[model samples]
Target: MKILHVVDMISQQRGGGSAKVPYQLGEAQARLGHKVTIYASDFHAEDQLPPKGVELKKFHCALNLLGGVRITPSMVFADFSQFDIVHLHNYRTLVNIIAANKGRPYIVQALGSCLPINGLTIPLHNFIWRNLILKRASALIAIAEMEIGQYVAEGADSKRISLIPAGIKCNEFNRRPARVKDGKKRVLFLGRFHEDKSPVLLAKAIKILNRNDVILLMAGYDDGCEKTMRRQIKELGIEDKVDYIGARYGKDKADTYAMADIYIMPSRREVFGLTLLEALACGTPVIATDRCGVASLLPPECGLVVPFDEYALAKAINEALDKDIASSYREYRIKWAKQYDWSKIAPKIIEVYRKVLGT
Candidate 1:
């Protein structure tokens, strides 16, 4: 099957699930003997290398509009019908709206963007796309069971929505043996340094913990909140405990995860915590907010699911790094993450596409 994946951008450093999901899914789909082509903006395109068996078509961003929507006028002239089916990632984008009306049976994996977010330009974007895209979509990919109602509320038929979780390549992360490392208990927060990801909250949690031995390895691309987080870290007098390591990829990311005693994701709202899987795949114990879709899948033996609160996150971090559970979690998490491997999840996605095409 020939598949077209339409996404806002293919830049992994953009530090959003939508940015990474399309390429990773496309890579996996291509690996399964399907031809996959990706259409996205050239934003940080150099930072990403498309996986083998995938073709990437990058269009120049003609206009950066309200809400950072990269308007690619070239999409208007591009051929979207050549593919057997199309998959749209990240809702509320101008390119997605254009591609949705291109007469191809395209499914939407909104990546939690379908939730009624009343952002600056979301209403206008939704108003333009509601009929052309969501209503006319072949299927809606819901990453979390919690997102089913969100799609239904957006005037989608529940039957047209398929619950599919994002997958990780277990081989991408090098699994470290469960051994005791002599160093400060490193707690990693390795995603967007943005408010939605709650990096500031994690900083506060670190401040609240007031621990001398534990260090916060705050890493990733700055999504407009690094200054605020850095200031807060300084204001809270925890600068010595927090290290700001900018953007890690490939081997660096896997080693970063493996080096940490605990990985914490304190997202206020999340569809699926992909980093949780990445961290777990590296045999790193994780703590994510209950809002994450992956939080439910993690057992107490390997991970901890906490609420979006500093005290709760602080406690979870402490418990995750505890001597008794930490060693055991490191050993068990690698086994736990193997179940959601992309090799297994890609076939389920192909099933959705085949069903849409009546194959």
Candidate 2:
């Protein structure tokens, strides 16, 4: 099968999970003997190229609007009919509209953008996108079951939607062995430093813990919230307790997950928290919000799932630290994450593709 993947950008440092998912899925598909080509605006240099097997066609973006939507002529002019299926990564983009107009059978992986969390205009945008564009697709890939209702509400046919969780390279994270109590516990918050990510809440939670022995590693790209986060940290006087390591990837990313005793994701409105999966895959327990789609996948013994509140988060963190479950649960966490491996997940996605293509 010849598959074409269209996304705005494909950079490890900038694109985050949205870029990584399609690239990884494309690689997985290629390993299954499918010819996959990813089309994106090449914002990164040659040093930051995508993985092998999946072909990448880079184009320059003429303009970027509304923070994420890119206007690329290359995408508009691309021959969509050349591929058996065109898979779109995100919606509300000019590229997606162009693809919709191209008369090819395409599939849309909403990537949490379909949820009407942004504002009134976004809901309207999504409603129109779903009714006019997405409804015509061969299928709509819902990363979480929670998102299926949102798609249905937006006028998508229920039967046209398929639930497929985003997958991770489980082996990439080097799982840690049972650790001896070193008197110091490390709490990690690894993702975009944004308001929606609720980094401020995590900082506040760390302050409430008031523990001298615990260190919080706040690492990720700044999404216009660094100043606010720094201000909050200073106001709360937890500067010494937190270290701001900007954007970690590859071995460094894996090592950070392995070293951490507990990983915290306090996102207020997350569609799916991929980092939570990575943390568990590395044998590190997680404290994620109930709002995140990843929370649904977690078992009670794996980690704590709390509401989106600073006090609740702080309490969960404190309780997680007090329990000596890390060593005992290390094997369980790794075993649980194995089911979400791309090797296992890709076959499910291939099944969806085959059904869509009627092959």
Candidate 3:
């Protein structure tokens, strides 16, 4: 099968998990003896490259309308009819609209963007995309079962939706040494320092806990919220207790996870929590909000889930710090993470592809 994945950008710094899913899936499909190509805009060329066995084709972009939407005029000149299947990642982009108009049997990966939220242009955007574009796709892939209703409500046929969780490179993370809490326990929060990720809530949680022995390490690229977070940190007087380490990847990211005692994800909403899975694979206990899609897949022995409240998060952090479950649960966490390995997940995606192609 010849498969082409269409996304906004291919760089890890800009695309985050959207870029990763296609790279991993393409690699997995290539390993299965299928031809896979990833078509994306070359917005950030300095970031990490895709894995082996997956072909990457990048084009130049003309403009970026919204912060999230990419406008690549070059896509209009490209020929997409040769591929057996085209997979579109993320919606509300000119790239996706172009791909959808190519008259090929395509699939749309929602990436948690299907849900209706209070926004000025989002409702109108979704209505047009859902009715005119997405509803006609071969299939709509939902990363979590919780997202199926959102698609259905937006006029997608229920039978046309396939629930496939995003996968990770488990071996890279599982090979790391188990997290050790030798001196002051380190609590790590990794992801964009944006309002949606609830970074301010994390700072408030640290302030509420008021612990002298624990350190909070916040690592990620700033998505226009660093100033507000810093202001909150200073206002709460937890400046000394928190450390800001800008965006980590590769070995640095693995090392950061290995050094942490607990990984905290206080997101108000998440379609899928890739970092949480990475923490589990590294045998680092986690404290995540229940709103995260991956929280449902987490084993009880691996992590704790609480509501997105400062006090609730602080209490969960206190309990995780005081409990000595790391050594006992290390193997369990590693074992649970293996279920999400790309080697296992790829087959499920392949099955969906086969269904779409009727092969």
Q: lDDT scores for all predictions?
A: 0.84, 0.84, 0.85
Spell out the clash pairs found in candidate 3: none
Against the true structure, candidate 2 reaches a TM-score of 0.94
Question: What's model 3's overall lDDT?
Answer: 0.85
Assess candidate 3 and give its TM-score to the true structure.
0.95
lDDT tens string, model 1, 259-354?
888888899988888899999999888888988878988888777888889999988777666664557756678888888888888999999999
Better of 2 and 3 by lDDT: 3
Q: Which model scores highest in TM-score?
A: 3
lDDT of 2 by residue, 35-82 (tens): 999888866523557667988887778777767667788777777788
Model 3 / residue 34 / CA error / Å: 0.9
TM-score of each: 0.94, 0.94, 0.95
